[model samples]
Target: MSICKIYFSLFLVSSFLTFLLSIYFLILDFSLIIELNLLEFNSSSLVMSILFDWISLLFMSFVLFISSMVIFYSEEYMAGDIYLSRFILLVVMFVFSMMLLIISPNLISILLGWDGLGLVSYCLVIYYQNAKSFNAGMLTALSNRIGDVALLMCIAWMMNYGSWNYIYYLEFMKFDWIMGLISYLVVLAALTKSAQIPFSAWLPAAMAAPTPVSALVHSSTLVTAGVYLLIRFNFSFSENLMILLLFISSLTMFMSGLGANFEFDLKKIIALSTLSQLGLMLSILSLGDYYLAFFHLLIHALFKALLFMCAGSIIHNLGNCQDIRFMGGLINQMPLTCSFFNICNFSLCGVPFFSGFYSKDLIVEVMSMGILNVYIYLVFYLSIGLTVCYSFRLSYYTMTGDFNYLGLNSLSEYSFIMLKGMGGLILFVIFSGSLLMWLVFPVPFFVCLPFFLKLMALLMVSLGIWLGYCMAKLKLNYNLSSLDYLTLSSFLGSMWNLPIISGLGVNYYPIYSGEIYTKIFDQGWTEYYGGQNLGKNLSKFSKFLQLLSNNHLKVYFMLMVGWIFFLVLNIY
Candidate 1:
């Protein structure tokens, strides 16, 4: 069998096993939740509930299903590649780890599974091993490690107070400083893992990986880790802590929305949009609305995966060109691909009657319910507008306008296998939201509104597309810089180090203005502030460390001689 066939088979097996497991969990309706044992010798056994819950099991099923689809999609998407075997192995490993992590009952087990998942994701990101891809892989690894450490610390802190099981803590937990710390750390971990502000840079860089990898990363697993964590432990987050999470998440959502709007690279636009969606998820999670967040996650995964796959087809057909400037009139050449693209893009904008509309409306309703505060409502609506804007921008650039592709004749339709996968995903993206609406949270008006929202979003997206098309047709240059910057800044977060001061706090800011002034003026008789120059100051710090190391080496040599003398005396 071919490598592609092997990978496809592996994906099917993994997906089927996970689906069976989810069903098994659903079937085993456990009567008892907590079975704890305490003994005189001091060991305690706390067995929290493990049977499937409506929310968690539903999410687990989606993760399994989406992952399988992406894997199947990859069979065609990544065909003819040399590392097909390695890709298949790593992807299957990723699917396994993600599934295990989500279903684990205890925090310790979850962390262990999460660590493995993170490692596999990193491997997948750098699967190409090119310079840029490698960098993206390294950055993703570092960011995820930071998140893992925070989660570990939170778990350790919780264990100190005897709360290792996730389900038990949610029900029996009380608000305290340790709990607050854990909540904050967990939020941080979630934000980083989900590619929220400040930690979002790596995601755009991650576009350097293969399109299949992007489809996998965005839709099913990696970025969703933080969200899964948040929802899994919703009860433990507490009230005030949830409020804080809501604030941060809202801010992240607003920013990422703008950042995605301004991006030009097809993959990076999707990456930024994924970050925005994560922020939205975080915002909802903070409201203690786990159901809404999970549902939205499901919808987002289906549509986002569709978008990425569609983008992949376009790029593949166009000879690997990713910039929108080189793509135009692609609709004529690849009608099905364009159709799928439109479906996913419409879903992204949250058009009524679409899957995105239902999920997004639920989120909006959750915010309106105001489990946290009135401010959350504002953030939600603002994010809604921003979401519409960015989604429109994405659709406008790729699907609409004049045939400006430099080498027009070079373009061709995507391969048969690729079309098959894209077609399946497009169908899902179009129908999943509507299906889930009836299945999970049934409401007549709510279900109906999504169709309208989808239409409205489509109208807005069409307007943008038309404007872009006209510019191309007339050969009039419309600079997208302003839009691009809006997107870029939203995700960029304080242009390097500014946020360290503003967001984290002045006490922790690496570069202190007051310290520089003190060093310049407070030095004996020196009237000038040479310390104001950052370059010279860093050089001096480097020299100071060097001197300290030199003195330490001399002390080490004397200590070695003393050790030798003591040994000689003992021998005598």
Candidate 2:
């Protein structure tokens, strides 16, 4: 009857439902036979399948398990928030939508579920309704819409080719221009959805939402949507555009990794790290190796979610302060939290004997197969190095620093329940390396290699940890405003402090010229950056439309004459 009891009941109900689905998925997983059905109904032929495939069921199982855990986590996590009822509703809706997305029979249903998930996530993002949260929600929703539009374009293209079904899309393997267009559109969709390249601006801004929102959206679900889409469309995607896709993925990984390097906000840095890692996943997806990519996705989701949740716990305990500069020596005050955070962070670095090690090695191993294009291999390797840079930066600064408590009077430890949840996830990240290797690829020799990728992973993690610790020892202030000034001074110099750089750089004489040419062309970069000023500048255009509105009688007479002219021409 109480609020907690009601939410607990709902969580239990959702967990039970997912458990049932997982059972069904497992049954399908063990069954070797895949039943394909070609049925004609309602004047349309439909090709559907009982997806008893190993990969689909495996991913479904992980999704169900993670959703259930998130439900449990939210039970305590969202207790303080006022909109608990609405939050629970959206959370349940998200789980339902994701279930539909993962198990949909056709592209249309998958898209429907994908769009639903996006909508619910937007609702979650704006749950606080503060100006900052609202702005974040709008940006997230808008960026996702860009991806949604790309997906729609791809769907339309596929429909025109009469291959709305993914299976059919794969079966028709002629690799035509239409297919290429669809592939490119899908990649664009993935890039935007996963917060890659230019579209990545929205994600770090998305940290304005609640901590749970960051955890759920960035770590486990929304950021992974694009990766999941790539996996779902694997057969179609892997055919011929692998090299081009590898190049783009490499660029995204590098750029986002650098962005994370420059960022100081804990959430923003992790957000960028998420983008970079997702780029790595996309790179693996480009290789057409579904098993490796999917496994990596699973491990990444587990540990990344754990890290985000730990970060949330830290922020919550510290009175909602998210800046790393204000946090230091938290391990002394909150040992359990620090330990769990470190476990997840180390897992993120792909330290040998961790789950990240196994999954990341798989991806790098596959990249090494690109003998002719060793450039891809180098990018992949460099991405791992960047991963170390950001991951260690996150760990040492927040968890193991010089007790830089920013005048906070009290610090509370994380709840036992939260620690228990984190501990479970940490265990997963610790041991799932061996579990996944044995389950997916049971080759003993391949699993047990020391002088190869494991050694590389260990060396990278150590070097990163040492370098980051040394950098932190120098007591570098992890403040963005300072870094911004430094960057502007170094990169922009005299242009840095200008009131309006573009405006100052422009030639005003062109605007002053007594010709209509300026009106036609010289709106300039200011118009793009400052749309309100652009509207003010374009008042003349508005006045012209106003004049048309004012002279409706003349406009009607002109329309009548035009109509008469058309009629006379037709008669002629």
Candidate 3:
């Protein structure tokens, strides 16, 4: 009937069917690969390959499920917009591109999907058409282009093997330095795609898009593409490369975690949390357990999608206001939405028995069981603590204090459609942790350590809560004591303002050179010689014509005589 209903039904049915199929594949330990010979040439058979395994099927199911919810959610979320159908089309394309990526093991096929993601995400990010959206979209597209180039180079390099399907050579890449270069390239692509330290600016800036797009892109599709690729290429990484990834992931985690504490924009705060969690996923993957990485990935996706949806509801009800400082006492008005928000925040903090707890606890124990040096150990635990810190800080600001924003009486949870969309996910976010753990990892990891070591996770979480309370504490009496530590709140001590420092530094030189070239070549040379000079000559000729043709018959006769003289000369 309606546009949202059509897409919702389609994606919902697909999600259900694929989820069952994924279970089947998982239980039977089965994978189906189909190859179509596109061209048969001399010593090479270029083929299109599609691989159906539990990972692809399950990931597709998740994408479909989230899409269904988002589309259904948009029934209300985007009802006022005139371009609703166009937005729906963009979202559909995004989900399908993600599915295409999930199924393809061939580098060429993966490129089709990979490039689709980059292009569609750019369009979606710029959908609002404001300067902020335009800038964010450009940043997103250009940053991802680096990864696209790396993937393209990877395809060219794989041509030496006479096949684009690197799935067959996963183990071989570990042994050969030449193929190992491909792994390095793939890692480079993943790092850029996943928004690792240097490339991470685009992730938060992309919040300029609609909240629904943020939910889909940041949660399960665009950002996860990189981590999923790494998981697929897990066996291919050399030990040295893995260690390098470990350090980079650690830095990314620490950076984002610290950044979130300073962020006031609610969507940006959640986006930063997504980046932090992604760093956690990559860090675990680098430590040689791709399963834990995927586990955390799925777990994070569930709660995060719901988290973003809840955030969207809050922003929508607040008349597009996203600043948390102006929002308070939401629990008194929009109790249901606040409940959902707090639950998601708790899950994010990896509170015991929640969905994030199962996977995060496992990962933490796995890291603890391993012999790691001091810096890595502290970074991992501290980042985890920071995760809790930001989440607590967000909740304390939004739900605990008096309503300080303009629309105090206007706040209410009349968004049944949006709540219904979030309703589809809350159960999964709460319970999927244990279910997935039992299903995927039957043999639990034995985390044997001393009593103090075992209590470290609890300690970090407690410290995070205390720090969050301190940051969010009200300074009603002009607390001079708190002002003394303003450095940590505003300047170098906080995220080191790194989203600016790290993200901007890489683009500074190239952007500066382009500006200089625009001024010198474009404005100075091209403007004067190409368009400006042409316009000047045309203006002079037009002035002569205007001078001659001041509604005078004599001028007209003179022009006619001149034309006749020119014609006579040409004829002669």
lDDT of 2 by residue, 89-122 (tens): 7876776777666665466766787798789888
Query: Model 3: how far is 455 from its true place, Å?
Result: 1.8
Q: For model 1, how does the per-residue alpha-carbon lDDT over 1-572 read when each residue is reduced to its tens digit?
A: 86556656665565566456545544563223333343335464544334345455566666666666666777766777877777877877887787667766677767877898789878877877888788678877887888899988978887876666656666555566676677778778887888776676677777887898788888878888889888876776777777677777777777766555545678877787787788888887776668778889989988998889889988887778888766766777788888888888778777777789888866775455443555665566656666666565555666667666665365666378778777766767888887876666544433334455434434544554454344334432334433343443332432233233233453444558668756667652354344445557888999998987879978788899999999999999
Candidate ranking (TM-score, best to worst): 3, 2, 1
Model 3 off-target regions past 4 Å? 37-46, 474-488, 491-572
Which pairs clash inside model 2? none
Best-matching candidate per lDDT: 3
- Tens-digit lDDT track of model 3 for 1-572: 98899999999999999989999999999999998888998997777899999989988888899889988998899989999999999999998889889999999889998999999999999988999899888888988999999999999889888788899998965698768899999999999889997788788889999989999998899999999999999898999999999999989999889878877889989999998999999999999899999989998999999999999999998889998888888899898888889888989999999999999878888899894788989998999899998899899999987987894357878889999999999999999899989878767777898899888888999999998888778422222124243555554223445445545566788899999999987788888998889999999999988877776798778889999999999999
C-alpha RMSD (angstroms) for model 1: 11.0
What is the model-wide C-alpha lDDT for candidate 1? 0.70
* Cα lDDT listed for each candidate: 0.70, 0.69, 0.88
Q: What clash count does candidate 2 reach?
A: 0
